[model samples]
Target: MIQMDLEQRQSSRFVRPFQVTNHEDETFSAAFEGADVNLTGLGFFIDDPDLFLPQQRLSLRIKNEQTDEVYCLEGVEVIHLRPDDSGKYLCGCHISHVTSNQLLAHHRLVMTDAETALVSMETSKLSEFNFMEDGSELSTDESDFQEASMALNLAVSQSESNQQEVARFVQSVESIFASTQSSDMKLQDLKEEFEDFKQYLGQMNESTIAFATLAKLLAHTPAEPQDKLAWKTLISDFETRFLSEEQQVAYDFMHQGLDADEALEIAQEYLKK
Candidate 1:
């Protein structure tokens, strides 16, 4: 006969259905119904009792049904297994090593269940008190239940506050991303405008160089008075087509008494504006 040891619990057990996947291949890996869990121990029904043995350590991934959160319980050793009336084994297990965060999550779950139980008890007592003919004062148990309910409400409020903080943080990140994206677009537009300005400057430089080359050639080459007159007319037409009003003024200054350097300076000053 397989001896079943009595369960020793340090914390109150809460009925919490969860999917349990066994890390080892020897036992069944499936979701067990009618599972109860505390901070350090778990009890659930299994189809085969013989598959599990006492002191057999197993790693388990437990996913909570209500919260949809998964918890890892390592060094989970089987303590006992007893045959139930429904032809299934009630396997009891103890968690040897549980991290602080994991313990806290389990604690919260247990607290939530305790709160629910207190509410149910309060409802039942209230109904009984209502029907009673005697106008009795509130019992000590009822007062205690109310106090516990208040604590649970406080915990729930804290949880809500934490959620609000997280939401605010996410909103802040989104705002920063939007601002950065806007800056990038502005920078791209500025770059394109700068390129267009550079192209305009390049075309002006090319036109200036062509005009200077033609003027130098006309000054050095021998020509008749008619040829010189025709050349001057061509130059005037070129100035009218390619040069701005400011540039034309500089050219007239150069033809008059002003030196070439002084006329060039005047043209540069006008172009700067």
Candidate 2:
């Protein structure tokens, strides 16, 4: 459970809800506390829960308690819904209209640190309980929890740092590609740079390995002549220069459309030579 202090401005006595009318129609309407307000979800919520009857529309009204202001939000989509033990349906809503001031007010309330900590603790307890049997040891040392938390923090920090490095590398490659004039040379340079970047990524965190692979592939696979040239030039200075003839042959065979097995065979042959 996340606890957040409700902003006074956003605290409403009631809220007016609106439903989608036409399957193709992008907008809908509903009555509010004697006034109607347009609403939109800003693309945040996507799922429509009621499966929204083909062409049928629904509306909801919510009132703000503090200001006694009533907002009629239209074109609301039911992103999520759950039925309680009492058979009351709770729904998560997204507004399709952007002009609703009530929607803006709702976002102002931010979660507090104490609330966040409680939620974290509850989640950890629940996870641990789910893994244990009835008689299993349930208590964990505070030190262990602290250590685990610190490790998670360190991992997140390392991931962010690696992302920043990759971003910098991509920017440099883009710059080079933009400045270069030769197409073939640019392609070669881009490939080399991508290979070097991949190697560097391998030496870093395993969590980011797939990301690095994707970035390298994207950096090298430009369909446009200008893009290819730009990438080639951008990567020229960063291109991984083969340290040995075997590595160079392997790189060449891979570029030549050789299968992985064939590339490996060529590399072995080059090494033997």
Candidate 3:
């Protein structure tokens, strides 16, 4: 366990008992024995050395446990009077104003025995429901069991869906690679027939059919470094052999149009393989 300073002084301040009632208007009043105190500048603090700011208006109600009387205080702002090295503050406040006999009635209600018993009973029941004993097993209600089962099934389904997507991507890459190989072989066969080869290259360039097919395939497959290197080499070789002076310009433009980041990603993926 982490150790902290245990020598620090700790004390509890017992204020005059009163009951409080909070209202929706971002205000709360404290009632005590038929008098209500309109409090302003109420806030909370901790023993840590960090500053705490209130997100909303501060208000509180104090109740007399012995008399069932309630007191309401409104419009209170908490001021950090003094802070220690550990960031703990000694806080104190004064009531800004008081109004109405309704506050006194509230104070009386809080100091009653019946009110004290009711509050104690509710607190005890809540503690019993929330508290866990040492070595005690967790208990699951029917709703909890159903939620667990649903979550398990959802996870299994998502796993299967991802697997299928990956398999489909792999298949697409293979198909495109096969088509490219076939086209390359055809180009090789027509090499001796210069005129025919030139014509074929022109058609290929005009259609951008092969590059388009490869691009689609690459889009589906995971981009690996090795795959990108191989692709670059293939394109370099094709450019060297079949690209005419004019076609080279078009090819350069098209290459530039492709996203460099995506190309690098494909290369990274190949490196992974």
Candidate 4:
């Protein structure tokens, strides 16, 4: 099986070594080096997730890793933040604006020997995982499609229709990409690819959605750090009660007499498909 990086964002992120020397904020002339974990002309993932706020805009000066090329991008929006295992935050931003020349320059600078090779290898794997290919990618044949359907069946054993639904979704994606492969590909192809993935993700089983949401929330939220705060809050009245599956699982776990930390861990795993 091809290894798939759970690309949680819409952009195709290239995760090779790169650096950004930035007065990432507007007010200071002084520059700081943020961890350039992944680079794309579209946006970047900066370190220190807590340092930036959601919906914030930044100005950055990015330096090329393999050469002296440097470029500046402004009005980059801090779209979302995810935490890595090392206790640092991956701050994702959107490149709201850039000139044509700057865009070309950034692309050229990032297409270094190491990054170029890394992108080519990863893109091949990603193409297999998605069941589509252009000349630049690895094609998934009919047998590969059958394997995928079988995998889907095993994954969502709760319902045969779930497997059928997902199989059809994948086939439609294959058709779209195959049709587009005959012509010269454009940025629109990228857009369509993401739309297809988003649609597939939306149609995922409840357990999968719940698991992904939990994965996202745990990576960012602080409420779990303290035993006093539950990831899900409880509000009870004389009349009615409201709680999510996560909340209910957590509540039951607590009632069974486990400590907060242990209960949280078990609840999270239980909700995952």
Cα lDDT of model 2 by residue, 1-273, tens digit: 111122211111222322223223323242111111211221111233354332233454444334443444344554445553444444444443322133223221111134432332232211111111222222223433432333343334446666877997899689769975688877887888888888879655543332232223232333445534443432221223211344335435655666434654677777786
lDDT for model 3, please. 0.35
TM-score of each: 0.37, 0.26, 0.20, 0.33
Q: What is candidate 1's lDDT per residue for 1-273, written digit by digit as tens?
A: 011223433345667766677655323346666477754568888898887899888887766777776666565789889998988998888766554334434444443543643432332211111111122122233433443333233334334444565565556555555564677775675566556656755655544543443333233222444434443443343345444565565556655555545665676787788
Candidate 3 has its poorest 10 consecutive residues by lDDT at 124-133
Report lDDT (Cα) of residue 45, candidate 4: 46
Best by lDDT: 1
- Of candidate 2, the 10-residue stretch with the lowest lDDT total is 125-134
TM-score of 1: 0.37
Better of 1 and 4 by TM-score: 1
Selected candidate, larger TM-score, 2 vs 3: 2
- Candidate 4 matches the true fold with a TM-score of 0.33
Q: What is the lDDT of residue 59 in candidate 2?
A: 50
lDDT tens per residue, model 3, 203-232: 544333333322322222213454344434
- Which of candidates 1 and 3 is the stronger one according to TM-score? 1
Summed backbone clashes in each candidate are 0, 28, 58, 0
10 residues in a row with least lDDT, candidate 4: 231-240
Which candidate comes out best when scored by TM-score? 1
